[model samples]
Target: MVRARAAVAGARAAWIVSGPGARPTMLELEHEQLGGSARSDDARSTLELSRGIPLANVADGRRGVALARYESARAESASLARALTIEVRATLERVRVLERGRQVFDRLVALDAEVTAAARARVRDELITPLTARLVELDQLRVERRRATHAIALEEALVERIGWLGADAGAIVLASEAVEPESLTIAEDTIAARGREDAPAVLQARARIREREAAERLLAREQHGDAHVAIGAFLERRPSETATADDGGTRELGFRARVGVPLPWGTIDRMAVEQARSETGLAVQDERVVALAAATEARRAHRRLRLAWSQHTRDASRASQIDADLVRVREAYRDGRIGLDAYLAEKDRLTESRLEGLESELTYWEARAALERALGLSFEAIASGATR
Candidate 1:
């Protein structure tokens, strides 16, 4: 009986081990298969997503390229504005110089008119010869003609300045001021340094070009043929046969994912990048050289002109003073019968010529100063204030 009980207990334990609850059901098997498929689908989707290009990088590069272009345009505009300012100031200064000279010529012409009238009266009264009167009239005419010609030149200069300032021919009236003496001491090294630091338009243009080229390189790097990824899902329904109990149908679901990359095959873009880089480098070196050479040439020329003008002005001023002193003595001698009217008239003419020369030299001096200002990219006011 004990052996029979042991065999029965062993059989019951075996049956319990292999019961329906212990075995996997059909629903559970289906769930396991679906879980495995879902895991595989997730992996495939992840791989596809990972293959996509970094579009943000490309967009950022493009923005950088645009910004570089804008910077180039802005620099060009600024350079143009500076050039215009220089032109305007130079022309205005020239107008002032010419006007001052014209005023001196006007005074000389008036004196000539008085002398010619006196000589004509003396001839009529039989006190002077007709030839002398004729000579005096001719001198008067010459002086008037010179003054008229100078006036025309002054008007033309004023018109030019007005046009540059964007004003109507008769609308703008520039303030009249006496021309002041410019500082005679300007260092060549200081001028060159200032030009390089703030006035070299070519250098600014070259830098802009370099920035643009660099931006282009960055854009090319980002846009080098990109990879793409795609994922899709679809559902389908199929009718079953013997659908009498209900509208029996089978459902199917499918998923797919794909990743692709462009073939690395193109030398044209690479060549373009190299070309841009080379051009940028060449511009940096060549533009700087050209600008520096031009600045040096202009500075030297301006310096020479200023020196010559200063020397001429000093000599003419001294001569004018001498002529003025001689004129007083000659007039007294003519009044006391110690000299003739012709000698007095001749002395007066010498004085007029000396004054004209002095005025001309002054004008030239101012013109030279203006040229130096343009070359150095600094005005007299700026220099006086110790501003760069």
Candidate 2:
């Protein structure tokens, strides 16, 4: 309820102070009327009217403060929205990575099961030891277990992310897509950091704070205590007994004017002014530090992680290619009785490990790219669209 009221007040203030068709002046009006009659006397009556005028400069300064506050709120809201977007994207990417990992594990399990079956058949024909068949079965079981663990972890992560988005668990249906490599060479770290300072919510929020404080200082300077001017008319009717002999029921009309001004107290006003100045100064310094530090830290850390992930991914890809060739040769050799079943099984295990490693490397690469986008205060789609 408090938040709702604040939102309503902010909207009203924004409209009144900054919206189109806003007037510079404020209008106030007042009216009063009275009438009475006694049995032994003539009627008596009175009427009064008044208007109030607010100082234009003071009013404008106050409006300026309100405008600054409204802008700060908007900046904060935008920052939160951006942060949430990054979180959702990162979480979705993690889910996708784990999903792909699970697929690799499934394939591994299936292949292991096939190898185990072949080993059992070989044992029945006295072509392989029973122990070899047992080892193959154990490998298959391990791969199955790993797949189950990965699936559970991925589901939990996805659910958590969906919850953060304020959606129902049943409503979320994640679709997998091809993961693309990040282009780190296109933009330098210093350039990205500079952009982050300009775009990051923390920096924007700090800058907004400084603006609001400055506006407050201006408002305090413009204010000269409190003052108002009132213009009105007064009218009265008197009974015959109170009227002069030449006048019948004396009637009078008069103009009324009033001006109110409070004596300015230097102590309190000076303190307020000083406080505003101090806050603005502090915010300015803080803003500079926060913007530079946040941008540099995120940019550098993300760049390093991305580069490392890319290198690892490249090596894993090459290793997987080599393993694939080795697996093909080993299988052919075992079928021709040139290599033992154990050697073929080892080659198959190596191939599985290479595939798993590649998946892990790809996952790390994607995660690093996502982190970089978050650090730079941008989204993958935005980066892909050539936005720095």
Candidate 3:
């Protein structure tokens, strides 16, 4: 937002500079004093105001370069805004994913505690070896360790979110907010179109190209050179040659005007014109490079998101199946049909499967966010189908 505001301010300044004007290249006021050599001499004073005007720009193309800059700055401001929004959204989703993952770890730790208790009871009853009980305790401790690690990561993610939002941590509440349960799917053509039309990098590059072109035109106009004109009125009085003479030596008051126009000399700064042309060509190439990169990234992100969603769906199904298996295994272990070790192993597998599913979900969201950035679409807009 700060960057966006700065860009907006620049645009405003450019617009103001580009306003209609026959701009004065130079303005001067002069003062002069003249004195005669003898005591009877009279003194003369003069004042003048003069200005230089660029004939080439005065009539039509005045500040054309500034006008082009204004347009470029306007586009840049919008691009900065879009980029800022994408950053915020991506950060928000990262925090959300980390929050969800923390919850999963929380559940895992609780389940590990229950399993450890059951393992200790089986050991006390002589149904399980002490080594087996120790293994369960170790597993429980590892889960606790992992939960601590996850807590640290979650805190870091929340801190990052706070910095991005410029908000207090207390104001950020995510537990009550429901997770995005489904993936958003946008058409490939829509993504491509958005990349070309709205992507911040592409837009900025194209705007720069236009800016360079305008600069070239302004430079070409400038080659005609300014017309320098100085017009002034002066007064002069001189002492009489002899002290007793009736007539003064001299007295004159007159207006003087001087004008200078450059001859249509050889090309003025051919190198500068060529440099401007080269810069414009480079800007064009830059736009193409940016456009190609945006298009490629948009396609790649879209594909990754599609793959993530598919993986999430498969993992979700596998987790559900593991959950069913765990229920049956628990029942069998209670009835003595399966050993406690077997039940514990199945429960561990269920935990792994659940974690896998959660991770897949996170991957899907990450990919979705990447795609949104590449296409220069906000998550809110995508979710609401605003672009569609």
- Against the unseen true structure, what C-alpha lDDT does each candidate score? 0.57, 0.58, 0.68
Off by over 4 Å in 2: 1-56, 161-183, 187-189, 226-263, 312-316, 319-345, 348-388
The residue-by-residue lDDT of candidate 1 on 1-388, one tens digit each, is 0111221121111111232332221110011112234322112111111234543366556667777777777777766666676766667767766776677677667666666676677778898799977876786687778788878988988889878875664454557333333434556566555454445465465667667576666746754666666554544444456555466455567766667777647677777777777777876777777677656755664566566666666656576566565556444543445434555566566655665565666556455545544453544543462533
lDDT-sorted candidate list, best first:
3, 2, 1
Of 2 and 3, the candidate ranking higher by TM-score: 3
TM-score of every model? 0.67, 0.66, 0.71
Instruction: Give residue 334's lDDT in candidate 2 (0 to 100).
Output: 38
- Residue-level lDDT of model 2, residues 125-187, one tens digit each, is 998789867876776687687778878987887787778766664465657343343445446
lDDT of 3 by residue, 197-243 (tens): 66778877887887898778777777777777877666667767664
In model 3, the worst 10-residue window by lDDT is: 7-16
**2 or 3, which is superior by lDDT?**
3
Best by TM-score: 3
Off by over 4 Å in 3: 1-53, 58-62, 173-186, 227-261, 266-268, 317-335, 382-388
lDDT, model 3, position 371 = 74
